[model samples]
Target: MSDVAAYPVTLPAFVPEHAPPFPGQPPAIARAPRSDTLRCSTCSMRAICMPQGLTPDELKRMEALICPSRTIRQGETIYRANDSFQSIYAVRVGSFKTVVMHRDGREQVTGFHLTGDSLGLDGVSSGHHSCDAVALEDSKVCIIPFHLLETMCREVKVVQQHLHRMMGSEIVRESSQMMLLGTMSAEQRVATFLLNLSDRLRLRGYSPAEFHLRMTREEIGSYLGIKLETVSRMLSKFQRDGLVDTHGKDIRILDHESLVRV
Candidate 1:
């Protein structure tokens, strides 16, 4: 397994705004490479998902069975609660938030997914979604049919290994989030969130320490189990301490090491 701490994480220089096609207009569609109809041959997330793990021929086979979907607009529902699970979704661009609502009207943000993140994988066995996935911005995803993927994995050792690793990574991420919620201070939670987001972007070939905030402070506070005012105050303190520079929604890490130590 690769060492997460040793991996170089950088943020992308440009994050394109995601815009969905106007309603009543036909949805635009594109075909994948013929060499692999079930998988995406030129997918940007392939490096994190399949490439570097699968052989050329295996990728070709997987590509042939995959279906690529184009941009989904911000605030659009990728899948609603209890929706039937058809395919696994891999984010090609932008971010997504999964939420679950309680009967008493409270909502908990279950997950925040970024570029190269995959959703709907957990529902493979149950065939039903337990949470709602919404795009935080205009985003694109590649949909891999579950049965096709399972068949491919059965035939390909590399594919199986990739799925195992992906699942393991998800487990670790969830555990980390649980730990943060259970034990971290408000300041520590915000600091860890920024550091994690920076690392994720960096891994995708973007600058690790500078980017725009796609989610609002209130949303961030809710996810962190803190007050919105607390979130604002901590950000201000971070700036005062020379740990980060924030101007409106844009932020630049002045000292990542110090920020992490916070």
Candidate 2:
């Protein structure tokens, strides 16, 4: 059975509501990678998810802080709004969508996360999660207890910087989405979304020109602040214009420059 099928939807009990205070300064990282440590050290997404320039000893120490990975099936939630934030997760496989519910019970998809992306940062400031992270498919995530991570950050300047960069990236992404919703045309918004996904996939060593959409048209519309029909219409226009070819959820960008022009 797949890991998702093997595990239940319920999240296992995690760290306490109040984590212990940060410990004293630790020694610097070592120089070589270790074969026996946690999967984070040998993970293919290590470069994207972890800080660079760590020695073997430092890498080992970082790996020690990670709890075993968790798996969830499609549509299952990894975390819910208002839950106490004890840890952050790195998407180790598949995709997820973070959504927030309006006061009237409408669901708004705030963002989509793919492999190597980080989740649960929204809770960092308030100590409670602000949105729900639901699996887009059968997925796995590496759990990094936040308090332990903070302790490591205090001892390692590089780790601290990387954490800041990750947080900054999230802010920039949200800003861009706001701009897209407020100013961009329907076609432009759709094109930009596809291009953004393509670029991110390329960075992760996946094919840039073609991939399957993990989220539905309705979900895409929600994230882009457009109607579901508008998303479908814009995609049809792109395909008709020979900029892209779509089959069901599959998308292939045929003319990158043309799509950019749109």
> Best-fitting candidate, measured by lDDT?
2
* lDDT of each residue in 92-158, candidate 2, tens digit only: 8889899999999999999998898888889999999899888899887777779878999999988
Q: Using Cα atoms with residue i matched to residue i, what is each candidate's TM-score against the true structure?
A: 0.83, 0.86
**CA lDDT of every candidate:** 0.70, 0.78
What pairs collide in candidate 2?
Answer: 30-55, 30-56, 30-57, 30-58, 31-55, 31-56, 32-56
Model 1, residue 252: displacement in angstroms? 0.7
Model 2 gets an lDDT of 0.78
Ten residues in sequence with the least summed lDDT for candidate 2: 1-10
lDDT of 1: 0.70
Count of steric clashes across candidates, in order: 20, 7
- Give the deviation of candidate 2 from the true structure as CA RMSD: 9.6
